[model samples]
Target: MKIAYFDNNATTRIDDLVLEAMLPYLKEQYGNASSVQHKLGRQGSHAVEHARIQVAELIHANPKEITFTSGSTEAINTVLRGISKSYRTIGNRILTCGTEHKAVLTTCEQLTKEGMAIDLLKVNGLGEIDLQALEDAIGPETVLVCLMAANNETGVIHPLQEIAEICQRKGVLFFCDATQWIGKLPLNVEETPIDILCLSAHKMHGPKGIGALYIRRKSKPIQIPALISGGKQEHGLRGGTYPVHQIVGLGEAAHQAQQKFEIATLRDYFEAELLKAVEESSIPTKGANRLPNTSNVLIKHVKTAELMTKLPQVAFSSGSACVSGDRDPSHVLKAMGYSAEDAYCSMRFSFSKYTDREEVDSAIQQLKEAVAAIRAHSPIWEMYKDGLI
Candidate 1:
């Protein structure tokens, strides 16, 4: 039995080119990137710098602005913690949205314990933030406003230009956890007025343990103190030896994604055809601007877990991969005004450029069968048959 993968929002399979590019670093070219004396060390250092250039191109940022870390989680921690410490004299409040990944939320929670005021901006029914509300949240004590470029679960895109303008007008630092698209979507940080940006490599077909944070180092240097201490690495922002293979893989992945970025309309067709076959199913945020490859689907009257279990060969997710083990309904869905039952019945299906029409068609068929098998056992389905719900 062949398996169908539709959980790309969680993580992507590393590209073949990325793996090929990492071979030398893992094998014969093993040397520390920080060592500048030996030939092997020079080779490793050169590769690391070249990878920085490649990754920088994806976001239209200066190579000097990028600081590589373990991944987005570390990158987020670094930015939040560094800013929390550096900006203590400047302000005490940090502004962010409610629908951010646990990474940003958890970091904010930590800062609150240290007496920083963490204010969560609310989103509308479609999982979108109110621009006016964002503007209202900024005050004299506002040090930073952290928002994601795209949601990880629902794929709803925030209006970056407008949000940037608000932050700029108020003279507050703007930080974006653009993990969803740092490796995939075309971004121009210079033109967008973003002060800081962070993203991971794994989301865009790169290695898992590598990521970068972009701090605008233009006219006046943006000050963010180092979170880790010891040796001088990542321009003294982060300390430790670089993971050579992972960094090389991330660079190759960024190059490949830039060269082969395909924005096809398969998601529309997938949702249309899937909805036609699977009656009463809904596409969350269907009326809003969402990522081209994501679909948060609600197959009403059928529990997503039971449906997934019935179709063992199909691989998807009930929510964000971070909360995969949690039995509670998705915090994102609940924030969008979905009832607990509706949230439990919803699953996220994502597609990559590699996802073909044949695979989507097969997944739809499997979904219909799974829904039928599970709904047959549901008391709610019986009530629906009697026009009770």
Candidate 2:
């Protein structure tokens, strides 16, 4: 059976063009990017720089300000922990949202162990943080405020520009984990005052194990100590021999994402038809500011775990991949005031450039059938049908 995959938020299928771009690096041009004397080594170094330029251009950042790491998790840890090490003396407070990925939340938790204050700002039902509360949270003691440009689960787009203004006014550094938003939307750091931003290539049709960090080098350059310590790659900040092929793939993915911005229409159409077909279906952030390619739908009287087993033709995610194994209902849905049952029934369906209209149509039919079967099998749904809910 052909699978209509809608799990781009967890990770994406690397584009063929990106894979082609990395072939030369993997075979003939294989050389340590750190080596300087040999011709192949110099070529590898030059290729790494070119990839840096490509990734930087995608986010409207300078090439010098971009640094490569394994992925967003490492990049996030590098900034959050590095800041705590360097600027902890200045201020020991870190602020972030409750809906952030485990990378930001867990790192902040680690910081709290070291006597740093970690504050989690609550989000409304629409999964939006209160701007006034954000301002109030930023005080003299706040060293950095970490927030994602887009939520991974709910697909809600946070107001990074306004948040940046607040942090700027309060002299607190703002670090954004833009993993879910980078390839799907336009993120112009030049226009926004985001001090630091993190993104992964795998989220954007790039290879896994490769990502970039955008550090502002303007009037007030946000500096931090190195997190990894070994070789002097990534300007001695990230220490390791660069994976030439993976970096090349990341650059190509960024280039492709910059060219492809029309998939949002397909995603919207998918949600419209799915909701029309399944009366019980509702999108979590339907009217809120959300990513164009994401839809977190809650189908009442159905558990996603049951639906997944039924819809073998559709590939999608119930929630964040990192926490899916924990078998817990989505923290994002729970934060939005969903009951435990509602949260368990909610599922995330993210689209990509490869998701065509026909696939979406087929997937909608499959979903309607699967949800109906699951609800029919559900005793609670039967109870509700008899007015006992």
Candidate 3:
């Protein structure tokens, strides 16, 4: 059977152009970026710098402001640890939303155990942070506010500008985890008042194990405590041997994304088709203002896991890959006021530029059939036939 991949949000296939760009580094150009005397080292350093520039250009930030790391998770951890350690003299409180990724939430939980006070901002029914609640949450003791540009599970874009303004007014450093939104949407650091932002290359058709963190020049660049303290690398924020090939791959991916991001229309077409099918079946699309490439749908009588198992040809997910094993309902859907049953029945379908119209149509057909089959097995459907649904 042919397979259809609609799980782009979990990870994307690396672009061919990006792989071509990284070939030399992985083969002939292999050298430690920290070496000063060797020609190989110089070449490696140059590649790393070039990748930094490409990433910085995408966000309209200076090349000097970018710091390479293993991935977004590490970048976030670096920022959180750095800020908490360096600025504990001023404040020990960090503000964030309840719907953040495990990276941010788990890091905050660890810091709380280390004696830092954490304030989790609540989101409204639409999976957005309550601005009034944010304003009320800020205080002199608040040192940082971390929020994601778009939610990983729900695909709902947060009001980063407004959140940034709030953080700016309160004199708290703001950090944005743009791992989900970076390549799919346009970003301008000058326009968005974010002080720091984290992005992963793999999310946008680049190699995994390489990402960058943007540090605003205007903000008092905090002396971040190093997470991996050994060699003096990444301006001492992170210390490890740099992966030049992966960095180059990330740069090439960013460049290609900048050039071909118009392919987002492919995702738009997928959404349109999926929504039409959902409407025909009387299924409700969850929430509003989701990303162009993502659709979270609730099939009333069908369980998400059962539906996916029944449709083996379709590649999709019930939620984020990180939390897939947990039997609990999605925290994001729960925060949006969805009951346990609705949350459990919802599944996410995320597309990419590489996805074509035919694949989308196939996915829709498979989904429709899957839902029908599952509902046929459901006792609720039988009850409905008996005038009890």
TM-score of each: 0.97, 0.97, 0.94
Query: What would the per-residue lDDT of candidate 3 be over residues 232-335, giving only the tens digit for each residue?
Result: 89877778899899999989888887864455477666666766775323223344566778777676767788888888889989888888788988777887
Output the lDDT of residue 155, model 2. Answer: 89
- Candidate 3's TM-score reads 0.94
The model with the greater TM-score, 2 or 3, is 2
Candidate 2: C-alpha RMSD after superposition? 1.2
**lDDT agreement of model 2 with the native:** 0.89
Candidate 1 residue spans exceeding 4 A from truth: none
Backbone Cα, N, C clashes tallied per candidate: 0, 0, 0
Error of model 2, residue 381, in angstroms: 0.3
Off by over 4 Å in 2: 218-221
Taking the tens digit of each residue's C-alpha lDDT, what string does model 1 give over 325-373? Answer: 8899888889898899899988998888778888888999999888877
